[model samples]
Target chain A: MSQFFTAAVLTSTVAAGIALATPFLLAALGETLGQRSGVINLGVDGIMLLAAFATYYVALRTDDVLLAILAGMGTGLLMGVVTAAVSVTLKAEQGISGIGVYLFGLGFSDLLFQKLVGTPLPITTPPQVGIPLLDQIPVLGGMFFDQSPLVYLAFLLVPVVAFVLNHTTYGLKIRAAGENPAAADSLGVSVARIRWSTVLLGCTFAGLAGASLLLYDGIFQVNLTQSEGFIAVALVYFGAWRPSGVMAGSLLYGLVGAIILTWKSLGIIPLSGSDLAATAPAVITVLALLFVARRFRQPAALGKPYEREA
Target chain B: MQRPVHRRALPALLAVAALVAAACGSSSSPAPVSSAAAPASVAPAASSSVTPAPAATAPASAAAAASGATSATTLKVALVAPSAVNDLAFTQSMVEALNSIKARYNLQVAISDNQFVVSTAANVIRSYASQGYNLVIAHGSQYGSTLQQLAPQFPNVSFAWGTAGSTFNQPNIFAYQANSNEGGYVQGAMAAMLSTSKVLGVIGPIAVGDAKLYVDGFCAGAKSVDPTISCIPVYTGSFSDVSLFATAAKTFVSNKADVLTGTAQAVVGAIGVARADNLPWFGTQWTQVSLAPHNVVSSQIYNWAPILEQIITEIRGGKLGGATYTVTLGNGGETIQFNSGFNLPANVKAKADELIKGITDGLVNVPQ
Candidate 1:
């Protein structure tokens, strides 16, 4: 048992877990804010993909990680705006529009990946910065301080988001608009503007999440994130529509991801003939979704199409 | 009433049209061409290139003997690679080999990249066949199933699929794999020799038939080198996932494996972690010495060029008709590259050289 929890192994495992969690956490937190406004933006996944590919292209060309990250965020903002235009402004069927966004992003990004980087090209990312004193702390040092600043920022955003949603006037209006848009509109809240802003901000988070995935990690592949967007969607429900709950959920998923790594690393789980271990995250996410279903409470107007006229 | 009068005339016109269509279908097999006319007529340019010409245009027997049975002046060969042609390794080797044949036989060649998909294979084959290409080479195991199904559809064209000889047996379908297992086996042997501990590890892609071949040969090669050696093998089920690869690499390190090898296209992740951990590593498909400048001790290189060159030359000479052709070290098909860019110890290099010579001299055979 002690061997399983050895200092070196445990530290590295936690480091890796955090690395894996960064993308999901970033996207889920963003979606949480979007959902609070009663807009279920399934387009988060598509937005992340466009950002991931755009990040790869910019990073490869400019060799500037910051510029590449900005490119990803820019793409994400565009995706958000498009989704906002269709679902929030036009009051289109939110679910169908979201699905359309997903399909378009998946196929279009793949075409882009093929066009830009037809073969594997070497990529170098900015070095991860270690916080001075925090990085020196034995086990915690490697786990928390050893990560890229993006990982720290993902965790930090959770509290900041929670504060905004729970304490700010903007947060109260978003809740009112999501629950009863007519009430908020009659109160001169500009329901359309609030939803659009939330959608854009949510997608900006998603774009940064995607940038973390591409530049923070060593290399890139076409459609590499696979269905991580869906995983982010599931995280929103599992968190029960709260920023704090969402972070806890992300940590739960991240821990499961870590366990799979440790188990396979320690040879606790025997891999028969193939590399099925990589599918562990998807399996774990599905099982978590099943466990959390009994407690799910969706917003009342989550998917309802709003209209000005009766 | 006026419309009803015109309906009778419309049926009469339709009946005449149907009669003509039925007559055309029954009188001749409407397959665009009759079997009575040999395929040679479909591409008169193709048959004329190989046939004896007028005395004035004919080259002397000396030129014919110099090139070894060059009946065809131009053997049009089409090659389809599943990956990019400029990989500078696996795909590049095949393309380079084809270029050599093109240079030698003055062969008219068409090379298209399938870019790793089964759907792309059929289209590439069809496009090349329609252009009257004499030989089509589908390079990659994924193309095996599709090429087998597509081979008979174009009888005038012959195909050579790479990485699996399973497609062989159809007269027009040929298969070639430059003995990848032999290369895998050599890598395994090198891993065993390089390991400080008696344990070694191999991480490969999901076990398709080809992957299983590499795994089995690797185990055989490792055990052959040291009887007490323990070989740990795992698969990540994907060809390009870095996180999964990192997990596998850490697992190898945890198991006291001083040396690790992986066959993932994205094995750089494994190699990166291995280098960071200061363990020796081996790789397959490409010379990835640069990936882990500190830990990648060697690689089992797939030089598919020779096999492609051989197939093209044989098809041009009217002598290459087999369901499959297997080439090994005995045929100079694959090579094991050992470079000290990984900062390998002097003894390790010496042992690697001995093994290289042994394999070359037929004294040591990395098991099939």
Candidate 2:
């Protein structure tokens, strides 16, 4: 424990936490957008898994990072389109349709992987780039600025998401749709369009997150996302459906996870105690949710499909 | 949407997430490592006296029996495994060993694969015992306690389990271990020489059972090569969580580890990092070249056939159980299979061979 407090260990652990938080932040921020626009994608995990596999395959075949990223986002966008078709246009129950998407993503990705890449193979990873002067800072810059570009993008999107949700006219329309779809529709805000747009964006972010997982080590396997998509979904509630809150929740999770991993590595936490400690993040999430659940309100029209008056 | 009013929406979402997480967690094995398992085949009947068990009765064993040349004296063997039979790691070693002895011993094998949950596994173990299977093998050390309880209840039945050297003082129990340290020590000695930075990373499932011994031996071996060599071991506390394994590997790389090695099936994740970083990886449990052909230096292959052969011979000699067997390099139970594709330096290979010979001939001691 004393050694864990040393600057070297602390910085490295914190740095690890930040790196680990990238995928969750991206995915959760996407969830925040969808939920604020009267949509919830339960199949986020599925979208991630499918995109992860696609990202790995493309990277393996092309060795083009941009093309691989686009391919992954394309997969997510395609899945998002299908999800919108079911939940937005067809008015299927959002929860059930999301599960269907998740199942599809889970099964089809593995099937494709086995059919295409029978064994594990490595791909070219995106190069790590450090911010010029920020990386030069003694310890802080190294922890915060030195990472894959995806990490910077993920963190930068937190504020971008907040601005879009809190300030833009489109953001107002999104808020209206989630709070009262009938009113948003009556006001000619096009609830369907707003919901469609948000869900697509949410899923594309999920795709980016998935692609980054592959980009991390250039490896893709069965269940690559490991259901991180679902955790992101839950994080939406943890953040009170706000972008900043979601970012906080993601970092909290990552930090807690990193701490545990470090402690185990340092032998501060015994192997027997590690399992119990591993559950800390979820336990913390639940407690935090329970504490905040009563304070913040979910969008009134969230998870409901709207049909305009004929 | 309003049906779950604002007050309850959070709880509702939590419930949905919980359900999704539960679904993911309930997988029989940890990951897709077992996706390549051979279709369960039945033993062939060698004589008119051989009768296959009904498919509805014990399907897996029935298939094994149907595929074998089963005779009247054939032994009914059941394997209770925590993962898929072809997981390419621990369970695969035992399955391969069992397959090797099928012809000589006339064993009718049944496998209950992916028994990770102890309660469910206990039920399957009980099922095998009640079916009067001549031999029941609980292949995970996690099942030791349950086996100890079950072994006494089924006194007439013979049982075996391992990567452990304990029979729980039960006369009807057989225990086995790979003494994996011998091979791990050799791998570590080679890794130390291979490293230019003199820093090494190890990914472990948990520090217990065979995992602890192998890691301890590895650290000792590296230090023996050069006392100043830095070899760090990190346990992800899971045998199947691939993401955690990857994270551990990244941490090591960030801390300047030049070479990597790990145990368990999930080590594929670490191997990926090693491949991406172009670092050599020493693998254990099985030959992992298929995962990272270029990165894998070599692997410590656990060949349990000889030990299985010994146990079978002993059992056939009127010994029900009460034996603990350790597979050693000298005993022909473990082999260091170097990857042919890897461009290892001549001196490194020679050093590895020298280390192997030393351990085999009992000239070099592996730290316990």
TM-scores for all predictions: 0.77, 0.79
TM-score of 2: 0.79
CA shift at B338, candidate 1, in angstroms?
4.1
Q: Which has the greatest DockQ?
A: 2
| Candidate 2 interface RMSD (Å) | 7.5
**RMSD to true structure for each model, in Å:** 11.1, 7.4
Q: Model 1 residue A61 lDDT?
A: 86
**Top candidate by lDDT:** 2
Give the RMSD in angstroms, all C-alphas superposed, for model 2.
Answer: 7.4
Q: Which residue pairs collide, candidate 1?
A: A275-B235, A275-B236, A275-B237, B168-B323, B169-B323
lDDT of all predictions, in order shown? 0.68, 0.78
lDDT of 1 at B243: 58
* Candidate 2 CAPRI level: incorrect
lDDT of 1 by residue, B1-368 (tens): 00222323344334334423432331111121111112221221121112111211223233334335453355677777754454434565677666644554556666665245568567767777778878877777777777767777877688887677565467677676556677677777767777778887777766665556677677777887897887757776666566567666765676577888877455766776676677887776767766556677777766555555444444554533454555555555556777667666677567667766777678986665
